[model samples]
Target: MSTKLELPIQEFTTPYPVTAREDSSIEELLDIVKNLKVRHIPIMSNGKITGIVSDRDLRIVSALSAREKFLVRADDLMTSDPVTFQGNTSIEDVILEMSEKKIGSVLVADEKGDLQGIFTVTDALDVLIEILRGRK
Candidate 1:
């Protein structure tokens, strides 16, 4: 077999994934995240990925709410204009972007302007380990 390792991200990434509307309520966003069992949820505006909110962000918001005791909307809580990755971007490039941004995940989008899956640090690390182990 060839030594070159093939990346599974291309197949693992869920193209046209579920997205949260900018106007979506925090409760709705929470429901989606819980149901989908995903850490990062892309916030879409005008059919474009505008921002992202991770489980960490949500927990922070929730903790703050518990202290101050107030509810917040998704738009009010999310990190706006989060870094995004194109589908064609190499796995290496994605890793670099996440590192430079100091973020855990990056939203994936396509040329037609649709929400694709998310690439988390976990995903990148999986790829890295696979490559190091010489697994195709």
Candidate 2:
């Protein structure tokens, strides 16, 4: 019997993920983050991705600019030029990349840079759990 390990990220990624505009207010992104229970949100502008916002970004902004909450926007705190990968990339590479970069998630885009989905640490954990179960 053989066990497969080199699975493509598309097999487990969260496709068509929720996104937000770079101009969105911190309060709005916070609401979305809480309601969706998702940490990373791809930030877009003019139908083009500009950055990614995360819970950490929001927390930093909120804590640093407590008096200027109204002045903070996604663009002000987003991680510009976030790491991205194609769906065909292997799961091992995904985890390796994230581990090397110390990031929790990466955007999934096609050759044309079209937004497809997101692959996060949670997804990686799920894959790990599946592998462990299969080994049992």
Candidate 3:
């Protein structure tokens, strides 16, 4: 049987993931997260990825009063310069980096460094489940 780990990460990546601008308001971010059922959103500027924001980050700022929340933007809560890997990178390599860095997700870019997708912890779990099932 072919081990899935040898495959390129792009094979399992969620391509063209939903993205946000640094200037996006908390309300807008919340709407995207709630409506789309996504846990992370890459922050893009001029078609380039600048940072990333997660639901956990949002929760931290959600405790603010209504007016305070309105004043917050995605950049305020985003982790700037998130780790990224080429789409053709091996799945094992990406997963290793994620585990070592304790990061929930990593951005996938193309040869030109254009954002292609996102691979999150949930995605890894799903892949694990698939591999386990195949073992039966």
Candidate 4:
């Protein structure tokens, strides 16, 4: 008898996560984040994943003055070359990596290194909830 294996990262990922361009002003990106109500954004360049930006990152540099915020760009504050994973990655392994590295999110990419989705700690919680509910 064979037991079902843990699901892949794709099953627990937020597909087509909100994205930002390298040239996007910090203020503009902040607006996107606020409007979308998302905490993380993949920084893209030429349709490829180049980096990532988080609300925390923005908050660290944002000031009371609007001009100060506008002075910064996504490229100026983004975490460059963030860790990325494939959809086929095992959910267990991804969780282990995230835990060991103490990271909140990982970019999900295809074989060609194109942006696909984002797997975040929040997504992990969803996976747990589904498992507990016997939905997976």
Candidate 5:
């Protein structure tokens, strides 16, 4: 029973994820998270990915005063230059990299460096659950 995880990540990636602009307000970010029920929002500048903000990141600043939150923007609190991988990248490699970096998600881009999608730890878990079920 070979359990090799060598498949391309595109099959499991969440394609065309919702994104935010660098200058988007913290409130806008929060709205996106709440309304869309998504955990991560890639920050874009000039149509290119610049950073990422996760639900955890937002929660960290949730304690800030209302005025302070209003003054904040996506770029102000996002993780800059988040780890990225091509959609064709192997699942094992992507998972290993995410584990090494201790990150919840990684952006997937095309060869032209355009944002393609996002693969999160939750996605990985889903993949694992599928594999385990197949083994049963």
Candidate 6:
């Protein structure tokens, strides 16, 4: 019997990788988040993932004044060098990393180091339940 994780990270990931430019306004990114129902948006600059903005990061802007909010950009508040995982990575490995890091999610990138998808704790838990029930 193979003990390898049957479920791949990509299987449970959110793809098309919504992203924001480093120079983009917080309002723009906020709008993206609202309209797309995305919790995290990767900050892309020069075709690279420079940072990442999470729902929590956006809330910090909401806590500020309307005028002050304009002063903020995705780059200003996003987490730099966030934990990232590969598309082929196993769910078990990702779950372990997320648990150890106490993070809710991690960016999923492809073989060429391009942003591919996102894997969240919620996604992992859902997979866990399915696997336990022999439904995967």
Best of the candidates, TM-score = 5
lDDT of 5 by residue, 9-125 (tens): 888999999999999998999999999999999999999999999999999999999999998999999999999999999998999899998999999999999999999999999
Model 2 Cα lDDT, one tens digit per residue, 93-134: 899889999999999988878889999999989988988898
lDDT of candidates 1 onward, in order: 0.72, 0.88, 0.92, 0.89, 0.93, 0.85
**Candidate 6 per-residue lDDT over residues 35-124, each given as its tens digit:** 989888888888877888888888877889878887887779989988888888888888888999898889898777788888887788
Best model per lDDT: 5
- After superposition, the stretches of candidate 3 with alpha carbons farther than 4 Å from their true spots are 1-4
Error of 5 at 68 (Å): 1.1
Give the alpha carbon lDDT tens digit for every residue of 52-102 in model 1: 778887777665654342356667778898776567776766777689879
TM-score-wise, the better of 1 and 5 is 5
Clash number for candidate 2 = 0
Q: Write down the TM-score of every candidate.
A: 0.78, 0.90, 0.92, 0.91, 0.93, 0.89
Please say which candidate is ahead in TM-score: 1 or 6.
Answer: 6
What is the overall TM-score of model 4 with all chains considered together? 0.91
- At residue 24, candidate 6 shows an lDDT of 87
Residue range 13-126, candidate 4, lDDT tens digits: 899998989999988788988999888899999999999999999888776478777778899899999999999998988988999999999999999999899999999888
| Per-prediction backbone clash count | 0, 0, 0, 0, 0, 0
Which candidate would rank higher by lDDT, 2 or 4? 4
lDDT value, candidate 1, whole model: 0.72
**lDDT (Cα, 0-100) at 7 in candidate 3:** 69
**Model 6 per-residue lDDT at 63:** 86
Backbone clash pairs in model 1 (N, Cα, C under 3 Å; residues 3+ apart or in different chains), count = 0
